[model samples]
Target: MSQRILHHPVLGSLEERHSVQFEFNGSVYTAYEGETIAGALLAAGVRTLRVHEETGSPRGIYCNIGHCYECRVHVDGVPTVRACMTLVQEGMRVTAGSVLPTPLKKGGHAN
Candidate 1:
């Protein structure tokens, strides 16, 4: 899938915007000033932000809004933050699924 900037027929040309640098899973990436974390990642061709706790299924942004938690990621040591709702800032550190705690077993011990 091509993630390049699109020239909308109605919107004509997209205005030139300032670019900021951020780290995704330890790799640096460039994103626009007002773009959300999910937007930036998608633009960079990143489809999965995390994995399912139980089945380890790759999960990406399912809802642009804050409703779904599929885009949950760790930002600056914080966990379970929704990527679709969080805006990307310069020098921000985003970890894909690493900060999520290990799943607990039936006896409450981490698996």
Candidate 2:
């Protein structure tokens, strides 16, 4: 028998696993129903989510609670989305753009 190596951490005892599909750099990735895109990305060893808007520096989740803006990415064709706070949905498409010195608001409510 053969097995595959695991990269992601085990989510604690979730009851149901809903299948959700999303794209990363034009590649497809799937996660459980309730998992965040950032969580799933980390599980799959995705370190860099977006590039710095100005400096073009690589960034990821500095704070899991959405305090830091390091893990910003574009979701569903929208730009400047905070990955730590954004929940994963079925067939969601995201784009990673360069970071900016000043953060911009999309929905007008700061996360």
Candidate 3:
């Protein structure tokens, strides 16, 4: 049930490419070479890349062009890498962003 676009009206058919394996949240998934992380994940039916830091709501790709930070995910232990901008690589480790503890105020309440 891949959502890959095999043919585009203007771009025509997709070129043949090798497949690569990457880990996402401890699960291994296959992705086509030269494809973006976001693209591959979406093709695999993975919509929620991460959750909102504060609200704990689901978050996924918003702007495929990388303008919006909604598609941000951890790649190879690095934090805040935009999934739409980063290309998928073999053996790469990707993890969904998680909520971090909020900064506390003078007493003990979160800011």
Global lDDT of each model? 0.87, 0.77, 0.92
- Candidate 1, residue 97: lDDT: 79
Error of 1 at 3 (Å): 1.2
Q: What is the C-alpha RMSD of each candidate to the true structure, in Å?
A: 3.5, 7.8, 2.8
User: What is the Cα-based lDDT of residue 15 in candidate 3?
Assistant: 89
TM-score of each: 0.84, 0.74, 0.87
- Tell me the deviation in Å of residue 55 in model 1: 1.8
State the lDDT of candidate 2 residue by residue for 16-65, as single tens digits: 56778889889888776777788878777788998877678788888988
- Using lDDT, give the best candidate's number: 3
Task: Please provide, for model 1 over 11-71, each residue's C-alpha lDDT reduced to its tens digit, 9 standing for 90 to 100.
Answer: 7877888999999988999988899999999999999999887668899989779898899
- Scored against the true structure, residue 44 in model 3 reaches a CA lDDT of 96
Over 47-104, each residue of candidate 3 has an lDDT whose tens digit, in order, gives 9999998678999999899898999899998999999999999999999999876676
For candidate 3, the 10 contiguous residues with the lowest summed lDDT are 102-111
Runs in model 1 lying further than 4 Å from the true structure: 98-111
Clashing pairs in 3: none
Q: What is the lDDT of residue 19 in candidate 2?
A: 73
lDDT of 2: 0.77
